[model samples]
Target: MALIITDECINCDVCEPECPNSAITQGEEIYEIAPDRCTECVGHYDEPQCVAVCPVDCIPKDPDHVEDEEQLMVKYDKLQAE
Candidate 1:
């Protein structure tokens, strides 16, 4: 599943640089993760980089964009091609 930055985000400006896919961006109120570009770091790391660095622990799987490992890998591959 794509990870989401909840409202609890403190805007620490940490998660943006950690995203290999460059999916995370500053939103109006908090940072946002683009689902199409989010692979949960499948191709680049063992775990989601954003989640690892977020101090608030607000990054969570997008319940609305659930996906299995294989699906995440496909998304990761697609992102790599771009």
Candidate 2:
């Protein structure tokens, strides 16, 4: 599934650089993840780098944009080609 940054985000600025897809961005209130670009690190790593580095543990799977591992991999491959 794609990830979403909750309101709990402290805007620490660490998560942005960790995203391989460059999907995370600063929003009006907090960081936002673009679902189109988020593949949960399927092609890059075993775990999501942003989740690993976020001290607040505010990053979570986007239920509204859910996708299985295989689907995520496809998205990752598409991103790599761009």
Structural similarity to truth (TM-score) of each candidate: 0.97, 0.98
CA shift at 75, candidate 2, in angstroms?
Answer: 0.3
Candidate 1 residue lDDT tens string, 1-82: 9989999999999999999999999999999999999999998999999999989899999999999999999998887787
**Candidate 1 residue runs with Cα over 4 Å from true position:** none
- RMSD (Å) per prediction: 0.6, 0.5
Best lDDT goes to which candidate? 2
Model-by-model lDDT, in order?
0.93, 0.96
Model 1 / residue 69 / CA error / Å: 0.7
Pairs in steric clash, model 1: none
Model 2, span 1-82: residue lDDT tens: 8999999999999999999999999999999999999999999999999999999999999999989999999999899999
Off by over 4 Å in 2: none
